[model samples]
Target: MNEDERNKNRMSNKVVNYVGFIDAPLNAKDLYPYNSKVGGSPVWMAQPPAKYSHIKCTECSGDMAFLMQLYAPLDHLPQFERSYYLFVCHKCNATRQGWKLIKSMERPRQGYNEYEEEEEEYDEDEEEEEEVQEKVVQNDTKNENGDDDDDWGVEDGDDWGLSGKTDNNNNNNNIDELLMKRDKMLKEEQAKKKEQKNNKQSTSTSSTSTTNTSSTETSPLEGFVTPSDPSNQYKECYVTIEEEVIKQQKMHGGGKGGKHGYVDDHSEMEEWSGESYEYVKDRAFSKFIKRINHYPEQVIRYGFGGEPLCMSQAGNQMFDVKTAYACKRCGKNKVFEFQVVSTIITQISHNKDVSSLDFSNLFALTCPNHCYDVGSDVHNDVIYVEELLLVEKSI
Candidate 1:
């Protein structure tokens, strides 16, 4: 079999099947030894009073899907008590892990009664005495076995002098044969164990040698069509408008500072409301909007799943960008869908108080493969921004 097939076979042999409700919430019935939920709602930070927000995948710029929330509590250190939030973007082969420390309420202590303390001490003493008695009995049995050679003239046999069966010679021969067989079987078992150990040592040595040889070699081709000619493709493209073109184009009043500019009638403006609005309004998208608000000269519009002005876009065309890239490890392409365009960040830096920053548009992408193999550290290979547009506006 091939390397991948061999790996799969080994994994199958080692896998443990668990059947139950995944991502179940902790309740009174489920106390002690907490377990993290998988692929469900995230438990946000409560001590700092933070809201739930989707983290953008670095590779794809798409919103990371919620993977799990781990609840770890410490008795002595309350500050260390935290919930870990894990998210994944399968397309980019990446993971976003975050933690939130929560404050735990002090549990009420039971009354320390003198009588209860006495009873506990008494119970522990009784248990110790019983254990001592058991050890003594075991010692006595060992002594009897050890002294058997002197008493019966045989080292281990139970037939002490053949008391009533002195005349039955056939029975004695049969017992001797049985003892011999038992000893033979035990020796054979020991020999087999030693052989197995030697085999394992040899296998390990061979494997180590093979690994060292393979490490020096380059990685094999993944079979994906990566273009050889670097000059054929450009990383970025730009569009510059002249003063005459701006005057001829139709103007609209929607940008900051009541600026008049050409608006694409075919393009649509998406508005995030309800829970989504609350989640993103305070995060990166909020900062992006504020940056745009400071600039009054440029007008912008959002576009999805198309070429950046002139160059042709690569990859399979789905209904949306969400279902573009699937999981490379488990090969689960249909079950889980990725979050398409949850949030967008313009090239403008929100940290600066300047009038405007460079760039015309921004986009985020995500891994199409979601919730395939839980807890596996598969590659997060989501695609980030491919091409950047440099627009020079002429008034």
Candidate 2:
């Protein structure tokens, strides 16, 4: 559904809405790489990409900084832990290709499939087996050295007792040997049981680690580099998440607000305006202003599996799911994940010069299948998949 249909559905029913706000400037320890004014390293979900091509500026073909990453895991897609990343190339900010938005989700298993984690052979189990073997060898050596107090009860042959009791002595020796063998077998069985118990515990722990973080509890950006830049850095701040229902109702309810329902007036001709008087009457541009003006502070309009707050009237023809946004990995149509609004350009533009980054909005269309390669190690496969990022430039 389009934004109008989505809004109408919410009027009579309860719906959740999300908006991204730049909370504060990054201090020294925020862990995310928000300083890259241009595209920086992606804030990886399952595993950092083997190659850095995702964040490379299409114009410059270079790795740089000023990036924002959102750890917004979807409730519907619970099996997958999701993180959305936005990187703008301020150096090439004048062009539409100057920015790239990425969505990374890690199910640790197939998202839709039942998660039955594979049994694993932990390092500790093997080490315990080695220890048990070493102990058995040590006990055998001690018994051979006449250490009766240690393992077995086979005494020296010198104590055969009386000559008449030779047959009895031989039987006793055989019995002692049999007892020794039984004890060794019992010990080996016990060791095997212990190994099985340890392996069970290890597998259980690994199975529960289905999130982005591994069982080791490593830092979120463990293998990836923490990006930093001073001059060209896009402002990194905590995302102030708010609801549209509260703000929209408060401002417009009881006929308290403006007649246009808090929408912006686009009839005026500004000195900084890039379009002519005729261009101001464009249907696409008018609708774009109406939605954004309602929540002007929102840099992002987030509704997973929802239509984008469309900017251009002719943009939907380009966003054809059957042709343009189809999943190349799973041979299915890509679904709408989220969109980064044009207001985001104001935050990412370096030194307020966004000549190339001039776009109305970016719609992230991801695989409906949530496909990832299931490797040999089912318990620890990481996927870094890139989906379609649709850009709608001003008409």
Task: Count clashing residue pairs per candidate.
Answer: 13, 11
TM-scores of all predicted structures: 0.21, 0.52
Tens digit per residue, CA lDDT, model 2, 340-393: 787875665444444445667777777767776556212224445555677776
**Over the full model, what C-alpha lDDT does candidate 1 score relative to the true structure?**
0.30
Q: What C-alpha lDDT do the candidate models reach, one value each?
A: 0.30, 0.53
> In candidate 1, what are the lDDT values of residues 260-363, reduced to their tens digit?
64432211212222335335334334333433343223222112222221101111112234644333554543321111111111321222232222222212
- Which runs in model 2 stand beyond 4 Å of their true positions? 1-16, 32-47, 53-55, 91-97, 107-232, 246-281, 320-324, 349-356, 375-381
The candidate 2 region of ten consecutive residues with least summed lDDT is 111-120
